[model samples]
Target: MSTKTVRVLALVAFLASALVPAAGWAQQTLRIGELAGLTGGIAPYGVQIHNARLIAIDEINAKGGISVGGQKYKLDLVALDAGAPGEAVKVFERLLTVEKVTLILDGIYSSVEYALGPVLKSKKALLIWSGGNDPATTVGVPNAFRNHFDGGAPFMKVNELFLKKMGVKRVATYGQTGHADFKRFVEEYLPKIQGIEVVATEWHPFGEKDFFPVLTKLKGLKPDALIVHGFFTDGITMLKQAREIGLYPGPLWLNQYGAAPLMMDEASRAIWEGTYEILKSSWGVTTEAPERSRKFFQAYVKKFGERGFGAWAESGYDSVYILARAIEKAGVVDDPAKIGAAMQALNVPDVPELLMPYKPGKLFDKDRQAYPKIIVSQWKNGTFVPVFSDFGQ
Candidate 1:
């Protein structure tokens, strides 16, 4: 062949080789299922979690995948949208039986977690999820593990501090009637605070947009603080309507969930300003936050163009790394029992890829639930800033 022809052929051969995996060193595929509410009422938070899962899987695969038994295995994520409990159960079964996904990253939605219990037990698959603050759902489950906030005592303590800081006396409660966790946070936990009396309580359906009538009733009750328990969209709608109807100036707003940056995205800064909240993660508010969190936030913004990326979605990202580390520790790629054991016994310091802060010793306690460090964050001038943290004290 002529020299020019040989040069062109060699260049084409180089490009083809680079496109294919190296012989004998090619990475194997390990499939992970991601269950989230990509549609319906919970879509706002679900999309964020899904995005984070994608980022984590991409980063891991880029770093030559997970090393197990001296072999490289890259993650293949299969995401499904199960916005409700009935749908979630079906999706959970599909992920196990059809998709054959033994490992899953479940986004926050406690009712769905409860519904998936029997299936998880039967399939013996590993489910690392967010939410399920109730100990009953998390404590004794064998295959189920939580990588999110503990809403029992730790969350209550932070809310108590928030109440004290706001000088809240009589509080009115409002939340979504559909979500068990959100309803319980407003009905069960808010009433438990010693000094504050739950003066008036009202609940709206999952997708209610107009809150004028309820706001009117709440305003007449004259509460010192109002507890809003819905997600960012509905939460913003309720607060904005409250301001329009002249109820906001009367009651100090206390968000039952974390103060998400998404709230500011949905509504203006002036709408949620001065709102007291129990922050799930101190990603932006604290200096001690994990370095990966800062990098992850930047990556998310670069990929998704920054609507309102919050730390709440970091659990999904952490779940991916947590499982990868477990696979490494177990020395096997496909065994669920060994992998689950490794995850349960995971030491936080060992997994530097984690974005959320975990309590010392292990990621999960005896209950198989990880307790995230709490921060009392409030909407200041234009951002959510930390006021108190349970980090050192």
Candidate 2:
């Protein structure tokens, strides 16, 4: 079976099996709507995220579901494909009105999340986003929570950690032209550091596969590093094209997923080696650097047979844990509004097996963002190995 089909079948099995435990309880299953892109250009990411999410749901079911107000309730994850922006809105509506989910995963895409703000407010359902790094989603919405960082903060942190300390003078970037966070990082944050100068910058429109022209432009400048701040798929194509044309950039900082060695062309894989990825967690990082991240990789490979990418999927796995924790803390599963409040108030001691590298002291900011250390990893020997640096909580 294809990886997507396997994941879907597993999801079906979990949804079917979850209800067995709730049979005796006062509460039915608590549904978390995963707003994903399962059939579009971004479908691969959804597959990785939802599959990771299934592992969490299965664990909960195995333990006889969750306890809220002294009653046990099962967890059910419903995957809603947000392909086209309009269709995504309709799917979000269906998840709220028809499926009546207690909460929805932030629609992975920001446009879907933007239109979803009113839906969340209208239905009073909770929304948790892990993959998107944009800050706008949680800025003013009480119902929204981020399992990841504000989009640009990690890049700024990267600048502070690597660029400033290394004393790199000139830098160039390949970023999404219209992306707010990328543009801001290149224009605003990169300039903030004392000695660095952003000499050459190139932009690519969304879904422009061939990056030869842009790479050609960047190669001439030969900056210290080619900081690529595009989406994941674009980064893959750009790196491959850059290498194929015999102008492979060095010390690339890819602001996207890097654990996609399974998907790359073999030659492209070699070219992508040593590229940097600002991520939250990694499998190799667990053993290599001995950081506090989920022991998720081994189990995930065992179950899914090695098609996963992006540590963001690990955040998706953590999302379920955080939401369930919030529900139990609220002592109620019926009201998402109460759960949202509980999520904000959650400062529980971190478990040993946490997927998100939540800070030693706290779990979330006032805006409901996790303060996980920005785990930066690189592609070494076809695996993303964490580059350890001391970061503050």
Candidate 3:
């Protein structure tokens, strides 16, 4: 071969080597926004949910990440602290503008979810939040989706079970103040439920540790059942104070989120004993939970060292999988409309990675709200045992 021919062959070899590296570097980074409460009142739940999300992303990436348009993209989380409703807007804006993340998993107060609706719609970003019971959270906001229980349907079932099974007719409620969902439950749904009389209703300010006065007044009414609504920390405080003041063990106590992981510590073990909680199905580790959920719970315990897992942890884990699947379904990562539609169209068997026990149908309704089955569990000794299940929407 001539020298000129040899030089041409060398040039072709150099071009092929350069193109191979460029093709290998073509992989993209898909940033999922995590707007959670790292500080303030939402921290306790937010930190746990955030950790659960980390586990999900790590698992997804380990499996070679998600595929969209034939390109593999690893998931990256851009987390920001937004505990309060006001701070949520600012941080959410940063997620969209600075972080440039279109898909977000927000696990915090419902008020924060409600407050971010306008921004979510305006920015055309997709959000899957774990908690938001108010209708406005998803009613007018098409971009926002809630993967966990919402509104009063589940609570209505809880009330019905309380009356029929527990034989409790008279009910008194003490709920967190400024909580829109709890307020609606007390004023709207509770009144409409048949065969139950709400003898007395009281409210407590947010983050209030002193529930002795409220419990004393509530106990005076002598209702057959006392239904309390609040976060896990507040539930622990109320349970401890109610036990100290001799109001709970006698009244057939049922509290929301009393079974959260944060309340499983030694400090709350005594009070949480025998207490009942109406919560999302398979919220924590349980033998009766689905096999996938049991594995998820065991993974959490293994990684987080047995702190236990509940609250929005399942929803947070499911949300990550949902986003990944939605991206795959849409076949593209840049278009929010297609991705959001794919997310809304998801159902059981479609996204088998989901841990939440949603019914057989589309994962979301017309309003993008999910209605997962609720479970009634009682804390026996130090663990939660399922008393009843399948009271869904």
Candidate 4:
């Protein structure tokens, strides 16, 4: 581990040892584990999500922690900087078998989740990711939950707004090929479309700045539109390059871009003038988010400034609250199956409990994945104009 990770782990160890109740009190300590990229390329995401988790923990602990059965418990976080995919597997194993944590949060990458899902399910430890929306992520894993599943309703809504409404016929898509969720989405969701055909599809590494050759090849296909799915930063860079090479093929649609205003610049923002982007919608800075969302946004801004809060920030916050609510409602935190049922039962719209938008009357699907519609925004000049909000699947 790096010095930073060591420091974080040391702090976690200290908290685990020191934060306990009186010997006679009816209070227990709940330990939650996190394995995310803290010192790598996705470090910003790790920091944003980890801090958001801390905010939720603080909020719950301030209310006398979680009440289970007939006792109260204080929350404690044990985090590790899961640097690479192999490291994520190691950390996940350590968290479960050694530290013996019941619930683990913030496996940010679909890659890590894909690798760890079977083991986590078998071990009966609950693992949740705030991001990873691909349908394949949930495929046989019963103990895992994703806070966003854009592949369902939010995804179709984008198709309706673009392919059907705008009448886009042929299209091209580009993303990080090595990404598990991206590949799964292409395999599962692409062929299901009725009216449109994907004329071209390209994949590259995450930070591949030279999209010239890729765009050049794609430009030759003469597709009606282009769909860009990947990191928001990559989307911004790809859009800029596509504009520079004069490969303006229909409207650009962005997915999983947790970044809106933070990733925009004068040069890149100019290129997205007519692009359409979809996201979790509840955490969007482009629209009028919930009142509590504003409060959460302001808190993050006050501490970490306004630049680093990705789309995952609100989901990270909501994930903790959801798990805590389930733990409290089930009256136990050790049983993962009961906790999963409690999570499913979070069907009512308790507005104050969420910093992100929940469905009008529900929480999770039958698979225990989040179900929320996406927001469609069109870039107009320097700002994003909300063209439509489709809550229907």
- Model 3 over residues 246-339: C-alpha lDDT tens digits? 8978887877653553436776766788878775555554436667777777788788865746656787888888888989999988888889
Report lDDT (CA) for all predictions: 0.76, 0.69, 0.78, 0.71
Candidates in descending lDDT order:
3, 1, 4, 2
Off by over 4 Å in 4: 1-27, 150-157, 253-256, 263-271, 350-352, 380-383
Least well predicted 10-residue stretch by lDDT in candidate 3: 279-288
Candidates 2 and 3 compared by TM-score, better number: 3
Once superposed on the true structure, which residue ranges of model 2 sit more than 4 Å away at CA? 1-27, 244-246, 249-259, 263-265, 283-295, 348-353, 390-393
Give the top-scoring candidate (TM-score).
Answer: 3
Worst 10 residues of 1 by lDDT: 281-290
Residues 174-198, candidate 4, lDDT per residue (tens digit)? 8776666556546666656788788
- Residue-level lDDT for 7 in candidate 2: 98
The residue-level lDDT of candidate 3 at 147 comes to 80
Ranking by TM-score: 3, 1, 2, 4
Model 1, span 52-112: residue lDDT tens = 8899889999998999876799899998888688888888889988998888888757778
